[model samples]
Target: MSKPPATILASVKQTASVIFLHGLGDVGASWLEAFNTYRIPKAVPHVKFIFPNAPIQRVTLNMGMPMPTWFDIHGLDQNAKEDQPGIEKSSKYLSDLIEEEIKGGISPERIMVGGFSMGGAVAIHAALTSPHTLGGVLALSTWLPLSTTFPKALISGDKKVNLPILQCHGDQDSMVQVQWARLTEQGIKAMGFKQYTFKEYRNMEHSSCNEEMEDVSKFIVQNLPKVD
Candidate 1:
């Protein structure tokens, strides 16, 4: 399938790129607003931001209602039914986007992949299976999907180490409980992923705030390739 169209925010002198996926029922344009609200472009100059739209499909959790989602949501439980095929497909799509960045002169090490909610789930899946070492992964307001299979799916050893991962979730997030995020951290650690940080915010729900965005900015600045 052809990749979904994106809302591109090109930098004056692009050296690195960030491919961010939107949550269920959201378009790339929506994230563009969030990025603008946070002034992300100014915070991280010379970095292209690509917000890709998820393909529209029937979401099982919503009673087979059609929506733009990274993958199907079979249930809410951590180990509930997962749409493995959809996850794999979206991961391949993400890889293709990364490859396109490489073709445009950005190294895989200079590219970061991230998302919100369901989108974050896809980002985690993609990063875990990626053949190339990414600069980092920003997963916000989300939980790891297919948790039971993650241990066996990880790349293992040094390849998985030193890859920065910023996971921020709300303590009051009813959509994806904070405990789920904790479990995700434990699973990744068990797989020998050392460079991971899980940040929790009080009273925050299934959404992000200015504080979270600030941390996100810091993560981008810290992970992106340093200039001489």
Candidate 2:
């Protein structure tokens, strides 16, 4: 099924892009509003922001309920069964989006993919499995989706192993807990992606805070600086 186009915040002199994904049950515009709240768009006027909407799908975790989800989540625990096909489908979609940006003249090194929770999981998968090297990936309060398949996935996919990564989590995150982020941090390192940083926010739950957004802004500009 064809979903709506992303909520775009095009730059006047666009040279770089940050294709960010929102959390489950969230529209791109909602995170677009969050970016506005944090002045992320203002922080980097040269960077075009593309927030794509996830297709509605059934989530087993939610009792077979359908919502705007990139993939179906079986459960919240780390050992829970993963929907590989669903995740890979979204990964391909995201990689295609990145390819489109590259075809439009933005270099691979000038593009980033990011998301929250489930979307963050997709971002990590799509970015790592992509054949091209990219600017970076912002994985917020999310874990590595198919952890058991890593290194193997990395080997067979002919993936890009080198790129900066920023992973942030909340110590008080009730939805996606802090331990999962820790495991993901270790998982990312074990997979040979060394340029990753894990930041923890105090007193923050399963949501964004001003400090976290500020860090995100810094990451975007630092990786995709003004080229104009």
Report the Cα lDDT for candidate 1: 0.85
Best candidate, lDDT-wise? 2
- Put down candidate 1 lDDT per residue, 1-228, tens digits, no spaces: 435656555556788899998888888878878987888878777788899988889999999999888889888876678898998898889889899999999988899999999889889888888888898999999877778876677764468787899999999999888999998888877777778999999899998988999999889988884553
lDDT of 1 at 172: 98
Worst 10 residues of 1 by lDDT: 1-10
Measured against the true structure, the TM-scores of the candidates, in listed sequence, are 0.94, 0.94
User: lDDT scores for all predictions?
Assistant: 0.85, 0.87
Deviation from native of the Cα of residue 210 in model 1, angstroms: 1.0
lDDT of 1 at 114: 95
| Residue 92 of model 2, lDDT score | 93
**Lowest-lDDT window of 10 residues in candidate 2?**
153-162
